[model samples]
Target: MEKKTDVMSIRVNEKIKEKISKEADSKNMTVNTLVNQIITNHVEEGTVFQDLDFTSVRKQLLKKLFNSMPKEEVTKMAGTMCKEFFKDTTMYLYGKYDLESTVRTLESWFNSSNIPFKEIKSEDSIKMVIRHRLGSNWAMYFETMIKAVLEELEVKTDSYVKTIDSFSFRAYY
Candidate 1:
């Protein structure tokens, strides 16, 4: 079934309207479609990001920082800080933190961070692969962080793999 939508009218500055029109044309979409996308994104993901006080940082800076940290320290930080971050963000976003919510939150985080990932699901397990160019330390951090989060959710992970630019793991619920 098609979802129902309500129509509302709002006034915008002429310059802003022109810019929106230009952007819509550039994207080969109608202004209405683009506006709906903007509203939906704001309501769904932007609000969560705002509430969580998320900030954007340059990828180069992040790569440098990750590279500078010792592997042991990176692992420890990921296990501790990233675990807490995932737990809290999942709870805040979903009102409850579980395997499903945590997975959803992680996907959203990856998307917002502009990271590429693939998730394959079966009846009893999920396999996630994240590809990046931030080196082995970043992969290690992700592996450790994912393990910590899954441990908190009481999910067992196996088939773990980490390379210089990618990480993958299979989690069984």
Candidate 2:
């Protein structure tokens, strides 16, 4: 027995159709096959990955490792580095990963550091809202420490950190 291919017509913008055609050609697939595969994927599986929370894994693993290390040493090193790295910026420790403990450790490490905000975790990723007092360089340094600490923890996770502008919705009046 052979499955019959039924002819279906769909209207789409010319530009979109052109782009789809190009992509299909690049992948060496016919338009019909590509569309069928997309539909089949949606129907068969809801998503590609099952359970992968990179952000939480990173935070948890780092928190564990840092907690294990001697607090005084990390604090001394961080304090010395902070003088050269961030002089005027207030470090706002944000994220759902153990805020109280992490803040305490960081405060102990850096004498002048301040924790202004903490983001609660509901789903997966953690968002830190650090004020721009330290400027972009300070933010970059903080981001570097975040990655280094997470890497040192050796957690099997992947993450994406980005700085985004305020999001707003507009309506036509």
Candidate 3:
């Protein structure tokens, strides 16, 4: 027996409905069937790929390749690239760079990206600590990125970073 489908009534512009109908005709499917398939795919794809998001997989794989090389060399090369990249970003153009604000923004970013971190902040310094998971290298990239941003903003900071058992850093601004 075929699965029963439910009806969903929506109000779309006539032109939009016509476009959908045309697309459905091209695919040899009814408008209803096409819309159903599109909506179903959109809803199910994320659940299917939840823990295996593309960025996570790509970074993990790249880290394996990167680990074979000299880390100090990578640290220097990537830090220079980051500085160049930030020098061209809109953030650098706007030029309202504050250490406290940047720290808060980075904290929010790490939290939203599901990267676990422990941080301590004070009037002149910020410390960030993160686990060096089996296939992720967050230390060098983050340290360089932060340093580059500071340089672009002309904020005087002394940065110390170490990536041993875990990635940890202290930045005095």
Candidate 4:
């Protein structure tokens, strides 16, 4: 352990202190170490910063531009980009990407990228529901990404509905 450089103190309710101590013990950590880590994380990274804020604005602007393009053209372009990103997964997937595993991978990607979606899988089909906050264009963009990934995996969609802020898609294996 590193030597302490500075000391600080604050008062907390007895119940809160007890809860924190119990949590630390449950995790097999010292209360002081757990509290210090929590405080450090709060100070160092409180929330999404300026760049992420600007990213949403940028997406809005780009969506407007892409909306002017032909729908098929824009979707194809987005699909092409997704294909490149997922191309190297051949070895990881053991040469073929099955429908459930492929969509599961997409689900994980959506989660880590902060895209809100609900995916339900069954033996026959997979349903993907996306609640896009940006706009219809972004929703369509994700739909394109999905269609492209399914295409790459050799899965075909049975039905799909694209609206202004949500995408409901069902695909078969």
User: For this target, which candidate reaches the highest lDDT against the unseen true structure?
Assistant: 1
Model 4 earns a TM-score of: 0.53
| Pairs in steric clash, model 1 | none
Q: What TM-scores do the predictions have?
A: 0.79, 0.29, 0.47, 0.53
lDDT of 1 by residue, 63-99 (tens): 8999999999999999998889888899888899888
Model 1 CA deviation exceeding 4 Å by range: 1-3, 7-38
Q: Model 4, range 1-173, lDDT digits (tens) per residue?
A: 99767878999999999999999999899999899877854443223222123123454666678677777876787788656555444224334566755665555445434568887878887788876655666667777777777776678786788788778889986
Lowest lDDT 10-residue stretch of candidate 1: 38-47
Residue pairs that clash (backbone atoms under 3 angstroms), model 3 = none
Better of 1 and 4 by lDDT: 1
Clashes of 1: 0
**Superposition-based RMSD of candidate 3 using all C-alpha atoms, in angstroms:** 14.4
> Which candidate model has the greater TM-score, 1 or 3?
1
lDDT by residue for model 2 (1-173), tens: 99888877899899988988998999999998888876654443223112211122333454455455565655555445543232212122222333233433333233222324444343543344443243333334455454444343342233334332111111111
Give a tens-digit lDDT track for model 3, residues 1-173.
99987777999999999999999999999999898876764464334334332234454665676676576766776678655553433233234446655665455444434566788878887777765452324456656677777766677665465564356667677
lDDT values for all models: 0.88, 0.42, 0.61, 0.67
Note each model's CA RMSD in angstroms. 3.3, 19.8, 14.4, 10.2
Q: What's the lDDT of the predicted structure labeled candidate 1? A: 0.88
lDDT of 4 at 140: 75
Give the best candidate by TM-score.
1
